[model samples]
Target: MKAKPSLRPEDAGDRPPFGRSWGVLYVGVLLNLALLVVLFSLFSKAFR
Candidate 1:
């Protein structure tokens, strides 16, 4: 009989797919959101 595979705490699935770390990804997302908000506010003010 074959033995079952085991799981480890050091698995790669726990890490970010591209960035250096999860914090970097979070920061990037937050920055992007802030930039979008600023641009939208500026557009609203200019159009009015």
Candidate 2:
């Protein structure tokens, strides 16, 4: 079997697939959760 090439952080090939920072993705997830929580609270209040 052939050996696979190792990826290094300093190498140009080692980059985010979305071409964006991981922090941006994490922030998006957090904002989405916040929006969902707010919507659910509104929905629960409407039913009560």
Candidate 3:
């Protein structure tokens, strides 16, 4: 029978060189804001 290989933490890629969570959050916020603006504009134009 063949044996399964064991996994180790060291085998994983190293952590990102710099923190990345904040960048993702910032991008999400910007996208949300943009979507809100577009929605509002469309609604306003429709009402007009």
Candidate 4:
């Protein structure tokens, strides 16, 4: 039998942001988008 090659190297830090996990970062971004939508809607209604 022959030895198989490795996929990932030994040194690798898979951090998303703020030292948090990927899922946490994703949720934060979604929440930020939702808040922006709400704010824009309010601003448009107030001006129009």
lDDT of each: 0.88, 0.81, 0.76, 0.79
Q: CA lDDT of 29 in candidate 2?
A: 89
Ranking by lDDT: 1, 2, 4, 3
Task: Give the per-residue lDDT of model 2 (tens digit) for 1-48.
Answer: 999797676665544577377678888889999999999999999999
lDDT score at residue 8, model 2, on the 0-100 scale = 71
RMSD of each: 5.0, 5.1, 6.8, 3.5
- Tell me the spans in candidate 1 whose CA falls farther than 4 Å from its real position: 1-13
Query: Model 2, 27: alpha-carbon shift in Å?
Result: 0.2
Per candidate, the number of residue pairs that clash is 0, 0, 0, 0
Across 1-45, the per-residue lDDT of candidate 4 in tens digits comes to: 899775454224566437368788889889999999999999999
What is the alpha-carbon lDDT for the whole of candidate 2?
A: 0.81
- TM-score for each of the candidates: 0.69, 0.62, 0.56, 0.62
Off by over 4 Å in 4: 1-13
Q: 2 or 3, which is superior by lDDT?
A: 2
Candidate 3 residue lDDT tens string, 1-48:
999797567545543344565577678789999999999999999999
Weakest lDDT window of 10 consecutive positions for candidate 3: 10-19
Candidate 1 lDDT over 1-48, as tens digits, reads: 999687575564667768988899999999999999999999999999
